[model samples]
Target: MSVTQQRFMRRGVTKFLFLKAIADAGNVPLRPELASANATDLSGAISDVAGWSLANSPIDTPDMGSPMTTNIPGEDKADSSSLTFYEDLAAETIETLLTKGVVGFVVIMRKGDVPASKSMDIFPVRVAGRAPAYSAGSDPAKFTVTFAISGEPTLDAAIPASS
Candidate 1:
């Protein structure tokens, strides 16, 4: 048994992530920023890495008439990311992006005792919204919009401003 162990927990409200919409000349959020952008609590940015698969090819062996298995190095796959937030009538950034279908960058900043961050420029992201659901159940009444990353996302290049 090891005597030393690193124990840590995010007890406060400091644990959070931000996704800053990057816009181009056409006002698209498809480009990532150089630094962490100021993000709001409503903005939920989620990024994931696709698992690598082994690339194999069939090879002919001299001794054996059957084809031999040659294992190639596994290739790295691109990431799939998504951002979700409530529609803000005062600030129509997300609403406009969803309507215009523009390209932009999503900068992600994860804060803990040791902060970890990454950024990705997504293109042709599809934005969709849901109707305000009001029910007897427990849930907030708000229009939610989700942005799906459709293109190759650049990693760790730019950072968003801390909000």
Candidate 2:
């Protein structure tokens, strides 16, 4: 097997990753205009750091050691992902949050050499909280947007062809 094939972990590129917001609550459509180059555009999306985590906790039974511990399936948990970017205060961007019209977020991890199959698409995340900060002490203004995974997230081994 190739060295790349034997590897279990693949390093993601931050530049290739993007965070998108859909005004409507539904499946995300992979449109050509949603590319990262047009991130500032209304049809495009924001930015995100790669390699965010997805995890779940398991219910356990006490005093079940010697042989094996019993673990019941608990609720699926998601670590909130935070995206930091400079605030341009664009009308479309500000309106999406101020008007509360955004429905969900999509994190797109573009495919690379390590993962030759396809890209990774994480979506349908709800906006849990957002903090748009401004400073007058020589520092630039930025926004920190946090999101919570809502319902069942579409996490696939490979990017879906229909996306």
Candidate 3:
């Protein structure tokens, strides 16, 4: 019997882009356009990223006739996500652009920057807050920006060929 090879992926290959010009009125840029010069590539500045998942809330349904209580999945919602970046005071950096109340789209390419092959997640978000994380020791200065998902996200969408 012949065995098939299974390969695993690494998180280091992921790419994060912040598109500040995208409006909050349900406007989603085409997949190909996400890699354009307009989008800010935040991969170099970011140190960590967390929570961009859509989770379901379970609703309990208890009936009078049944001995056991039943539950069903309720509305799906994307939880508040955050991105930690190495603080940059230079002009037009992410720390300056991701101020409070800023609205934009966060494009995450999980399978690398290959066009027309890998998939990505598009999140319409509003900047909830941005706070600095100062350390007393030898650690580098960083800041975390929280985002509230403003609209429905495009999950696992295919990346189109670059124009």
Q: What is the lDDT of residue 24 in candidate 1?
A: 51
Worst 10 residues of 1 by lDDT: 45-54
User: Candidate order by TM-score, highest to lowest?
Assistant: 3, 2, 1
The lDDT of model 3 is 0.81
* Evaluation by TM-score, superior candidate among 2 and 3: 3
Give the C-alpha miss distance for residue 84 in model 3, angstroms.
0.4
How would you encode candidate 3's per-residue C-alpha lDDT over 1-163 as one tens digit per residue? 9989845464568888898665435444665457566688888888888898899999999999998999999999997799999976665477667889989889888787767654678898999999889889998889999999988898877666667
- Which parts of model 1 are misplaced by more than 4 Å? 1-81, 87-93, 112-136, 157-163
Q: Superposing every Cα of model 2 onto the true structure, what RMSD results?
A: 6.0
lDDT on C-alpha atoms for all candidate structures? 0.37, 0.49, 0.81
Q: Of the candidates numbered 2 and 3, which has the greater lDDT value?
A: 3
Query: What would the TM-scores of all predictions be?
Result: 0.41, 0.57, 0.83
Evaluate residue 46 in candidate 3 and report its C-alpha lDDT on the 0 to 100 scale: 86
Model 2: per-residue lDDT, tens digit, 44-156? Answer: 23433422466778898656456677777787766766655566755545435422234544545544422333455555655566676667798666666665666555554
Model 2 lDDT at residue 42: 21
lDDT of 1 by residue, 113-141 (tens): 13223322223344433334345877443
